[model samples]
Target chain A: MNPVELKYNKEHEYAGVNGNIVTFGITNHAQESLGDVVFVELPDEGATVTAGKSYGTVESVKAVSDIMASVSGKVVEVNTQVLDAPDLLNSDPYGEGWLIKVEADDLSPLETMMSADEYEAFVATEEH
Target chain B: MIGTKRTPIYEEHQAAKAKLIDFGGWEMPVQYAGVIAEHHAVRNKAGLFDTSHMGEIDVRGKDALAFVQMLITNDASKLHDGKILYSPMCYPTGGIVDDSLVYRYDTEHFFIVVNASNADKDYAWMLEQAKNFEVTVDNVSDQYVQLALQGPLAETILQRITQVDLSKIIYYTFTHGEVDGVPCLISRTGYTGEDGFEVYCAPEFGRQLWRKILEIGASDGVQPIGLGARDTLRFEARLPLYGNELGAEITPLEAGIGFFVKLDKEDFVGKAALQLQKEQGVPRKLVGLEMVGRGIARSHYPLQKDGEEIGFVTSGSFSPTLNKNIALGLIRSDLAVQGDVLDVMIRDKAVQAKIIPSLFYKRG
Candidate 1:
């Protein structure tokens, strides 16, 4: 099951904030839409990612989609496992598939992120 | 969206919860389950495809052989009864009208299957060309439903339901018979590299046949494949999709299927122009590429050599069978040599790729 306590973005990324460090990955909904993750290209550690900007890309058998950063932060850690085993994104999007760890410049953007219940409703609307 | 066509087995696709997409004006299933899984299923076991959108045209008359010989780039006069020949119908300027398969029922009767998107246009062009010869061209696309049962297990699965001894129907040949009491024409042909059959029957019986085949083959792991895996399967085999590999502007010689072009046997459409173009040499040719960099090279992605644009990818995908990013690109013939290194511009990033032979997969 998805971690219910984590904050979610409309672009289908979930972020877990422990103090100023935010650990984030694409949501289960995103992985479902993009079947069979074959490759994942992530930003290197020490790269600064802006809120509402693309920081990486995920490719499946059929197509590729951009992975967006939900909050302004400097990437402190990159998930090396995902680079070698991309299918982990589909199998464990909330846990071992977590993409990057970033130290946030401000936690204000986290306030604007939706709760798990709100994100579910948002996905329902998007499907329609 | 209002007038897009639907095939006889459209309901079957819906029942499976397939992801539908607009392909050549037909609302066809792109995937059921998923593309990679479906692709592997076809490569390892068996998969069924709803190919009803392909257009069938009947060409018959006293002068049918001569008329067909004049129309296509292949030597149609060589085909005997029950044999099928793949050919490209071209314009006088060496531009393709469509790549089609010609089935010889007799000297006076031949059936041509054209690409779905080019159905109306191909019919119109044939009619316009018919004025110079004595023959009748009938577009019978709406009357038949086509199913492609493909893979290693295809023969065993189909043999259980049909009375027409599958062994007698050699590759590139066909025979008429009944499947589950439904009259049909079964051909040992397929676009996928695997050995398979293309079953053509009455439109009304499509759904029944689809379900029965799936039910019979269910225990053997038979899956109802969609257009997504169909494309990848064919692409892996180096089979060209009309709009992508062969188009109004791309000649068969330039596309690297020149073996089908009979330049010496008969004077067909595009013969004179193709002869001249061949003498001067084709400026561009199709080549296969494998991504050496971390990004996928998608269709229409620009190709560069020494930082200058050379060509663009026609079809590209992550090959499930090969487990690599592969692409077919039309680039300058000079740069088409094997092992040549080039760069594909994916979005704004440049990805390194190496030139390889066009055929990516071959069945053992």
Candidate 2:
């Protein structure tokens, strides 16, 4: 089971919110779907983000895909470690694999995201 | 939109939680655990693959062998009964039409397996060539399903179900036999560069055979592999794919597959053009590349020398066997040499790469 503290987006990203700042990373399911992560292009610090928009790109061994922003915010910090060790997304997607921390424009977007059970159900439906 | 078709095993792949992707024109399973894991499984143990999406054609009549000989660069007359020959069918311009495996069942009967995406075109090409020969060419792809059991333990697992004495079957040989009472064609050939067998049978019986193999070989660590591992395994072995290493524009000699071309064979299509190219030398050759810096080289990625495009990658992957980025590129014949250094443009960045010989891994 995934940790309850981290909220999941419909796109499979997990964000842990604290006050106005939110730290986000992809979920284990997303990492598994992407295969072995080879490279991560992270958003720059202080960059503005819009909910449901692509903020960065993640490349796997086979193909590249965009990492979608789940909540509107200004990027507070970016994880450089993931650039060097992209496999962290597969090993520890919720912890060390965190891509960025964002200072949110508003926290209301959190309510639109899914809980663990809802996300699990959503994934199940999509698989079928 | 995914414009690929699905095979009979599509539902089975979904049930196994395989990640499906568009391969050629088929919606096939790319991987279940992952490409790396499945690749390792085929290397160390047995891996099962549902290769039903591949095209199978039947040629039978008095002039089957003669007809096939005129269509391919390889000499079909040299193939004995129960023997398989790998050859490239070419156009009149000496460019490859497609690479295929020809199985000679008898003097008058033969089977050919081709790449899925080129099935229709290959069939049409064969029909056009068959007008002069007294042979009937039938595309029987949909009537059959193919299952590949590959690895070091493949023989052991497969021997449990058949009474044909697979141990006596030499490499590139095949036999018609029954597995669990189901009629099947078992061939001792594989693309993973391993000692394995490919089983061909009716679609309904294929599902039963697959399930039976899994049920019995579960203890032996046999897992249903997907196309992800299939590609990586073949890549590591330096096997050529139709679209990547071969196309309507590239000849077998240019792609470094001249071993299958029998120049002395009685006149065949593209023979004159290939003879001319052989005398003058092929313009380009396929070479292997190993990335030096941190970047994955991919298909169509440009190879640069002194700030100019020298070649482009045909196939590339992060080799699970070598644990590094590896690629195959078509470059000028003069520039194709082992240990030579080049640069690959990846996302506007030039990454250092070394020209290595093909087949990054070979089993002892």
Candidate 3:
């Protein structure tokens, strides 16, 4: 998982933007902290997602966590692989575990997102 | 770790890169490799657990048996030497003080193991109750550490490191033995609903014994389990956890542990209240819930019948062995029948669930 290319939300979500199609997923650190994901409740394609709002949820045996959006947009694609095999979030969080693709309403939020270094430092101060 | 206590195996857990969590004020490992993996290992092979945080109390005196009888809801007379009894200590109102295991070594000596979260409160309650009897209750929690190696292969794997005749030790019975030169109380008991042993030894030797058990169990797929899996395993077995299933407000009869409560016993603490509840019919009953709709039914989630609140979930999770979302709920006894559809509120939305028998999984 390359951290350099990713922009992070304080809520532990990530955005990988290529043109207007931005990919959304929980970060590797988030998945590791969550343990094995048993189920995922994701929004269908064409659903709207707002920056800093919950777009979906990821659940493990012990806990349920909201997956917040980093970029506001209408969802273009939903990763059915993770919905079918949720452990992809634990095993390959950066690649196969990507949750949704969105055509950005505005890419402005991307500039405000934390870099890998800043995100790591930010997480260090928050209590688990 | 500021004010929380640490068990002797704290270092071992750190060495394993375990994720530590504050469990009942004790800095314990919640998981090592992962919760789901460790859970599967226990169900299929064997898993060793560091349950050293459990509290131990020793009661001694000529009136120990009689005293125990008065304190617990179980029939103490049924216990003989080398036997164990699961009982709930209760308040006069029939509210649970805590659920504990009583190991009867003799008429004058008994060992009680209590939940870690309720240890201090239980000890205080015991001490207060001791004023009525000649027995002396000593909180010997600091003197020892406890470990459970559980699963289908638990017996075979444990037999390699201990000289104890594992075959002779029947369920709910205990014996003394030395494991790899360390003195221990080898009890054929476990919370995981598996055939296994609970080894209690001095705290200083806890790490050595823990490592040795894992090392010897390496080839057999034995792994170190954490609290996450332990709870799930016990829940699947319909074991009543203190705060979850049994509490100061929940009676034993309602918790579905009535089998352990000998209401016919001459007398015990809360006997009058429990007897009355039994005669009147238990108010709320614990039942199993299988999610018919999306979302897991987590603890404290409201359960409803036709939009009216019926009860709440005590414990809920995705069962590793069962491979689905399941929960143990305490609901009105009238609506607690099997196959009844109910609503479990998850995030203010009502999700459909069906009531089922409490034991979601049982060993063959």
Question: What TM-scores does chain A show, candidate by candidate in order?
Answer: 0.95, 0.94, 0.93
- What lDDT tens digits, residue by residue, belong to model 2 across residues A1-128? 66788789877888899998998889988998899887787778889999889888787878787788778989999999998888999899988998999998888888988888888888889877
Off by over 4 Å in 1: none
Model 2 C-alpha lDDT per residue in residues B43-66, reported as the tens digit of each score: 999999999999999999999988
The residue pairs found clashing in candidate 3 are none
lDDT of each: 0.91, 0.89, 0.91
* DockQ-best of 1 and 3: 3
- Any residue pairs clashing in model 2, and if so which? none
Indicate whether candidate 1 or candidate 2 has the larger lDDT: 1
Number of the top candidate by DockQ? 3
Tens-place lDDT per residue, model 3, B268-333, is 889999999999999999999999997899999999999999999999998888888899999999
Model 1, residue B265: C-alpha shift (Å): 2.6
Off by over 4 Å in 2: A1-11, A14-22, A41-56, A68-85, A100-128, B1-6
| TM-score of each model, in listed order | 0.97, 0.89, 0.97
Report the error of model 3 at residue B219, Å: 1.3
Error in Å for residue A61 of model 3: 1.5
